[model samples]
Target chain A: MIVVKFFGIARIKFKEKELHLEASTIKELAEILAEHFSVKPKEFKQFVILVNEVNINKLKMFRTKLVDGDVVMFLSPASGG
Target chain B: MERLTEKTALIIGCGGLGGYVIEELARVGVGKLILVDGDVFSRSNMNRQLMAKEETLGKNKAEVYMKRLGEMSTCSVECHTHFLTEDDADLFERADVIIDCVDNVDTRKLIAKLAKAKDKCFVHGAIEGEEGQVMLVTPDSKVFDKYYKSVDDTIRHSTYSYAVATVGSVQANLAVKALTGKGGKFENKLVIIDLESVFVKTIEL
Candidate 1:
């Protein structure tokens, strides 16, 4: 099971702080989350995805594979000062 | 503490985050501060901006801060009553550290690029609602490009006073560390603060 966490606007929008789900890659996880939240898959693009505290962009981006016990975080960068 | 008396920090924006950052840096005895902001204080700013008050309404933010700091600290404060642009790139060359407290991402991107070009330490701080984040950007850091993209401006996020003060204090602390030669662990990391949930953590970039 992967523990998915949401921060900033993502948390408010998704209405869930965290969820436990099973997925092999970030893309699959996004699909699952979009379905669970009833939002478009494209909405996930706005978040900065991190797998186990490391940004997915440093790995394989959306193709980054996930394993059991991995912690995934979806964070929206804040723009206000 | 004497080291801070010899260091200079350039801060962009004089709003909520900028207001707190300036106050803290001054209180800590940072030698000089160069503030740039074109905006004036509105009634809406009185709630969150430290320098915003009924008397300061409609006055240029940078200028107002300069006057306020002058009355309180020995730190030399300068002001530019105009928005920062590529033409103002020379300011980065004069600062020992560059801080981003701007409200928009485009200006933040510009500060990152300028800091990289000048090889100066850059500290970023921002807040939206109860959520805020701070990051220290070194000359070679690529966290900005990887994490931030063009954001839509249509949706305005509410800003709270406590959130602004929280993030701004962290940013000022990092800048002080950079100036005083104290190593900061926030390089290539984003420190996220959720005031509502009372959660704080750093995510490696």
Candidate 2:
């Protein structure tokens, strides 16, 4: 099981701050949230996901196994000056 | 300056995003601050800019920002009152962390490259319209080339909104986290926020 923190729009969508899921990878984690949140490509829920603060892309998503203490955080991209 | 102890930050703009980032950093006891901006507060900046006001219009952002930040803390706050361009490498050299609050991409590129060269931590926050995004880059990452994309790219769009304050706050959080050396987080990744969709996910670049 991994603990994921929702940020920005992610927080607004789920109406919950985070999720504890028994998943093996970031991809699985994303799919779980996508299904739970029912996100659509049309809606454009474009956020950069990080695992332990490092990008999930750096690891194997959906396939990235987790240890009991591992942490995941979902975040929104900030476009500011 | 002693209050910050181990943390020192350089804010590149005293505008919208910069104002909020500075407010939070100073509030949390960032020891030394260098506020760099060549522009003055303007009427158009009143929308979402905390430091921008009708009476403050035309006033140098660096000056106004330093005055406000000083009141926020007794720590050292230095105002450059000049743009953080290629010429500001000296200022960048002195920062332990650099928080970007400028809207233009070219300037972003300059600071990004400088931070990389100096091996400093760079925290970036951007907003266009109702959309905003934040990302962290280190001496080893090329995280912002996407922002320099053509003028029409989605990355270049920014908006003014009080509802979107969280986005900038997150960027500030990322910066502080890096400064504290508390852990390895917000490194080499972009956090995108679209208020319209109400969902956030991390896209690996």
Candidate 3:
């Protein structure tokens, strides 16, 4: 199982901060969130995704493979400074 | 420690996050500060802006904060009543570190580029409702190039003061750590903060 964490508005949308799910890649994880949140898959493309503390964008992005005990995080954009 | 007592800091905004950043930096003993912001304190800013008070309404944010800091602490503070642009590159040379408290993403890119060119460390912070993040970008890191997209949009109009204060405090802490080379953690990574869940997660760049 992979631990998927949500922050900010993502948490509110999902009604929880984290969950455990079975997934083999970041793409699959995003699909799970997309379905739960009722948002289009394209919407997940703009979010900042990290797998095990490393940004997926720097790795293989959605194609980045996951393993047991892996941790995934979804962070929305923050604009106020 | 007095390590930060002699260092100079440039804070790019004086709004919600910048006000608290300035307060902490001064209280922590940063010797000099440069504040920049073009807007005036409005009724909308009172919700989270530390510099926005009943008497400060219609007053320039940068000037008000500078005066407030001057009276509260011994640190030397300067105010620029305008948004930053290429013309302000010279200010970057005098600063040992920069705290990016600007709300606009395009300005963030400009500050990052200027910091790289000037060889100064840039400490970035941003917030939206219950969410915020902080990152330290040195000349070699090039963090903004990886984290930021060209598209500039802010979803939330205003969030609670609690989140802004929390994020501002973190931003000030990072700036101090960069200046002193102590208590630093997010140099090449981003620290994502969620006040609702009380989670502080750091992601590698």
- List, in order, the clash count of every candidate structure: 0, 38, 0
Which 10 consecutive positions of candidate 3 chain B have the poorest summed lDDT?
B149-158
lDDT by residue (A1-81, candidate 1, tens digit) is: 999988877876777888999999999999999999898888998888889888888899999999999999998877899
In terms of DockQ, the best-performing candidate is 1
Position B62, candidate 3: lDDT: 93
**Separate DockQ for every predicted complex:** 0.65, 0.21, 0.61
Q: Which ranges in model 3 have alpha carbons more than 4 Å from their true place?
A: A8-20, A57-59, A67-69, B183-185
For model 2, residues B40-65, the per-residue Cα lDDT tens digits are: 98887787888788778899998998
Candidate 1 local lDDT, B1-205, one digit each (tens): 8899998999999999999999999999999999999999999998899878889999999999999998997799889999989888899999999999999888888898889999998998888788899998888878776678546431357878999999999999999989987746668689999988888998786
TM-score of each candidate? 0.93, 0.69, 0.90
Ranking by TM-score: 1, 3, 2
Alpha-carbon runs more than 4 Å astray in model 1? A63-68, B150-154
How much is the lDDT of residue B120 in candidate 2?
A: 89
Please, what are the lDDT tens digits per residue for candidate 2 over residues A46-67?
5555677666567764466667
* Candidate number with the higher TM-score (1 or 2): 1
